[model samples]
Target: MAQISNISKQLQLKCSGERFYELFKNKMDSITQMFPKKLLSYKIVEGNGFAHGSVVHWKYELRGTLEAKQKLHMDDTNKAITLEFIEGDLFKDFEMVAVKGEVSDGGSNGISSVKWSVEFVKANEGVAPPHNYLQFALESTKGIEAYLCNNN
Candidate 1:
């Protein structure tokens, strides 16, 4: 039996809530492009892009070639979007594994903080997933940070 584990990482970014959402919604492709090769291979497998119930196909090269379908299970009416994995490689199942781009704080100085996080669990015992999860996340943050920071 594979023991299930959860891993979550967060990042704080200086940007406004509304602008963050705008960048996230409008620039997802650009954001996706920033992801490492593993995440970049993942694609929405069902429904329309970014909507609830949408399924995304994710592939990681380091872990014996597995595909995980992430389903957008919830989008907060006010604050967040959550995706649950319905099927595919590495895990028996997973939920809200990759979370990013949410406003954590707002300020009067025309500045705000955005937090991004990713949480994932192994599906079974003995299956080592990719080692670059954090690296991938950080690179993504750096990419978005540079884009937003430079444009702002």
Candidate 2:
């Protein structure tokens, strides 16, 4: 059987949960601008960007330059978005990979926090846990928060 593992990280933000959710929902076209050093391109190759049923093609540098195609599922009520990997470099070592990002109210402070999780089925147990990927999400979330607070 394939070995399955999950990892997650959280990032605090000055922006509201709604604003954080809006990044993926509406402002993803500006992804490269927000993280130019990490993300090379993010294009909606199929379906639509606003509602559900969309496929995004991402070309980015993690440990190295990698490309991925993913289908997006957005939950407005929960303020969460999921990206199910359809194809790309991720398949080289994993049998399955799904990434979920959730934005929530940060208690009394009224700040926001984004939680990112990666669930994966490894091709073999020899593969290390996806720490860098989770880190990437955290960094990206921070970038979004900074971009929104400073630019918008």
Candidate 3:
């Protein structure tokens, strides 16, 4: 059987949950345009754009230039978005990779908390965890927050 594992991180966001949620949920395609270093370009290959069940083809710069076909699953109630990689370079070491992110109320001050979780199945027992992928998510969150702070 393949080895499955998980990793997660919680971050205090500098922006409101509603702002973050709106951008991520409604304007996902702009991510690559906003951060060209981490993301190159993305195209909605199926479904109604960022809606649940949609499939997106992403060209990104990770270890190098890589492309991935991912399915988007969004939970509006909890402000969570999940990206399941059905095909990509990730499959070289991972049988599967699912990344889930949630934005929520931080407290009365109206700050927000963003949580990122990654679940993966190793193609083989010798494969290492996707720590770099998680790191990319973390840095992206911070970059978005900074951009929002400066722009909004």
Give the best candidate by lDDT. 3
lDDT of 2: 0.84
- Any idea what lDDT model 3 has? 0.87
Candidate 2 is scored at a TM of 0.90
Per-model root-mean-square deviation over C-alphas: 4.2, 1.7, 1.4
Per-residue alpha-carbon lDDT of model 2 for 1-152, expressed as tens digits? 66568999888778877878887888777766778878888778899763467998999899899999989899988989998999999898888998999889777878788889999998777888778888888888777778888866
Clashing residue pairs in candidate 2 are: none
**lDDT (Cα, 0-100) at 8 in candidate 2:** 92
Between candidates 1 and 2, name the one with more favorable lDDT.
2
Give the runs in model 3 whose Cα sits over 4 Å from its true position. Answer: 1-3
What would the per-residue lDDT of candidate 1 be over residues 101-132, giving only the tens digit for each residue? 45544556655565545556554445554335
Candidate 2 deviant stretches above 4 angstroms:
1-3, 107-109
lDDT of each: 0.57, 0.84, 0.87
Alpha-carbon shift of residue 18 in model 2 (angstroms): 1.0
Error of 3 at 33 (Å): 1.1
Sort the predicted structures by lDDT, highest score first.
3, 2, 1
